[model samples]
Target: MPLRVHDTRRREKVDFTTMNPGVVNMYVCGVTVYDLCHLGHARCYLAFDLIHRWLEKSGYDVNYVQNFTDIDDKIIIRANETGEDWRELVENNIATYYRDMDALNILRADKYPRCTEFVDDMISITADLIEKGNAYAADDGVYFSVESAPEKYGLLTGQNIDAVRSGAGGRVDGTGSGKRDHKDFALWKAAKPGEPTWESPWGPGRPGWHIECTAMSMDSFGEQFDIHGGGHDLLFPHHEAEIFQGECHTGCSPVVHHWLHNGFVNIDGEKMSKSLGNFWTISDILEKVDPYVLRLSLINAHYRSPIDMNEQLLKDAEKNHTRLMGVYKAALELMGINCPPLPEGDITSQVPLVKSLGLLEKMAQGFAIAMDDDFNSREACAKVLGALREMSRMLGILEGDDLGAYAQHCVEWLEDTAGSVLGVLPTREQTLVEPEEDPRRAEIAQQVEELISRRSSARTAKDWPAADAIREELTALGVVVTDTTEGPIWDLL
Candidate 1:
């Protein structure tokens, strides 16, 4: 199936077609660098990361650019409260952003243009808007004239512009600034007492939040790009303002081809908020949960569906991660391949594993179908985990070269699909490492082997009751025995 995506503006799933074939110029709205990233931020970025991976996997050279709002009201507030320089505060928070994203295994964008870097471009755009009669300068700053382009008002949010104009929905209001209409938003803010300032045609002041994205994205990818993605919360005033500014300034009707927005991350069935005591920073969550498990938990739901994050969700993710990795490690050991500390290099260079197993091929096909359908990672992840479970059950029955080759095929399939696309599996070395050695390892191994021997004998004699009793005893000892065509094999649970 061809790639299909849910376009936020059209409110429908359409075939994803880039302006230039085999190339995707994608821009994702990034975090404002004032504080550490939270779960909502993680969810947004992870959704894009999955898209990035799949795009590249499907043979598209994706030029992904994500910008940072380095200069913002929140940064200024945080700096003043902490008695730190605003620049220093922005730098520190950016560093923490990288640390958190790296922990989640999110791929970095090609360019991270800070809003401060594009101040000159922002001035030019704001000035052009004024010259073209799309914006007007006021005592406070320049503001976009929503009246000039009334049609673009509800392109993204689907609000009734007539109702908003009539003040029927309580949507229209004044900002108390020197602006003509309440629907009009600021293009630039006038200089304040101690806030950061830049020389602009409007005055010596910083750019507004919405204008920063417009300047940075256009500067990176020109007047038009393929995709613009952000959180659902940005679907309103933030993104709507971008549309008005970009199209009005450049005379380009659609600045972006496809608009994508990920759903919110709710905590325990409630919106995550500091006042509600449910807010969780990425660092705090990583401290308690494994990063791989956290990635699974975040992407387990469709990107357009709200994820209710709680202890139970995380525990379930951990269990799934454990089961998937357990089979993967066992397969590598059977193949006599010791996984190095890093990922196996260049999956494409390796020869495709022969499709001798029907289950493996079915998994590959099912995974592709799920991912093709609007990057349905939730379903894709389910297919991977379910297939691995089946492979684990088949591990013990075969022996010698057949077993070894089958194991090798399973490992390669996993590395190609789950590791490459989902980003859920860990490196080979991480899977093989144990946190601590069991103190009674030798005694337990011996006991398990003896019990397996008895169980094998009972089964050979057709004494099902004796074999079942011995199996229960093994379970009590934290051991699981799989009866294969060759014999019953046991492993520590």
Candidate 2:
């Protein structure tokens, strides 16, 4: 089956078909660049990153674009409060955003068009809306008339135009705002003193928050694109307004083919907010948590499900990440590669992993099944952990000569799925810094393996003292060894 996602507009899981075959044009709503990014920001970006990776795995040429709302009321307000230049503040925050996301290994978007850079495109779109009678000029700015397209105004949110008008983000009816209706949203805001202003058809003012996206996406991908994604909070006024404004401009029904929204992140069993003092920024967490572990924790839940942030969340992610890393590192030490494992085969295991490779290939198929069904990342993560467990079990019993190719295949699966695609495995520099920090640990680990091999030979031949002596040497070197039903497992103390 082809990829299908929960379209917020359709409010159903529908197949994602590209207007052009094998080409997916996806746009995600990016950060507004006013302050440091929090865990909520990480959740949203990680969801789309997984989507981007899966599309590539499925052999599509995906042109992914995310935007930065560089010129916003929030940015302006923040700058005013801090007594800093708004453009400087925006530039600094954008740099900070990249620093936070890069640590989590979030893949960079193809284009991050700033709102300020595309003001002309926005003005052109607002003019088209006004020319079509879909918008009207007011003393404050040009407002998109809610009554302009009654049949299509609130389709994204499933509310009728009337209900929306009453609760249009607190714009009350008969208010002195000069709007045709309370739900009427602005396309162009009239310029204010000491604020960044753009030259628009109406006057010197900046574009409305909703108009910025519609103009950016429309100019980048024409009238329609494949996927539009953001947090669930965007479903109402922000996204709905985008649809109404875009469709009104081009007479197109839906500006985007599929709309995907991720659920929110709650901190410590409550909604995360600055007022609640529970806001956890990504930078603060990265100080203690491994970036790979952070990525794992985020992927543990389905993207559409709200994430409950707690100390245990990060702890469990750390444990799971360590376990997977142990398996990969152990498998590699057992087959011996110190970096991201490369098995000299296709990523999908088309050519077979000896016999174990075949099982891994089937596991890969199961991973795809989850991802294909609305990008069920939790299910896919389960498959990654399961494969590692089976590989570890297989590692214990197989003879060294026979284990070579089979282990390589299993390592390849781990590398392809959990390593490259999920972005969990540490890069070369990170792996080199793991404790012992010794380039000679690999040699020492190989020595341990040889000792273990000798002990096994002694046990097979019914020589107890030699086995005990080898075990004593391992212990003397600070290696902790324990016998499992499968075999003996060792950890460096």
Q: List candidate 1 stretches off by more than 4 Å.
A: 168-174, 336-356, 434-493
Q: Kindly list the per-residue Cα lDDT of model 1 for residues 1-493, writing each as its tens digit.
A: 7999999999999999998999999999999999989999999999999999999999999999999899988999999999999999889999999999999999999999999999999999999999999999999899899999998989988998888878744444445688788788999999999888998877799899999999999998899999999999999999999999999998998999999999999999999999999999999998899999999998899999999999899999999988888889998888744432222323243322232366567778899889989999999998898788767876867666667777877888898888989888788887778655566656698888888898889988999999999999999998888977878766667
* TM-score between model 2 and native: 0.84
Query: Where does candidate 2 stray beyond 4 Å?
Result: 164-176, 336-356, 428-493
**lDDT (Cα, 0-100) at 231 in candidate 2:** 94
TM-score of each: 0.85, 0.84
- lDDT for model 1, please: 0.88
Local accuracy of candidate 2 as per-residue lDDT tens digits, 1-493? 7788888888899988999999999999998999999999999999999999989888999999999999888999999999999989999999999999998999898999999888988888888888999999998899998787888766777887666556576556556665777778888989889988977767798899999999888778999999999998998889989988988998887778999999999988999999999988999888888888889999989999999977899899888898888787776656633334334434445433344555666778888899999999999888888888778877876665556655656667787888777889875445545566455556588888888888889988989999899999998987777877888877776
lDDT of 2 at 233: 93
Taken over the whole model, the C-alpha lDDT of each candidate is 0.88, 0.84
Best by TM-score: 1
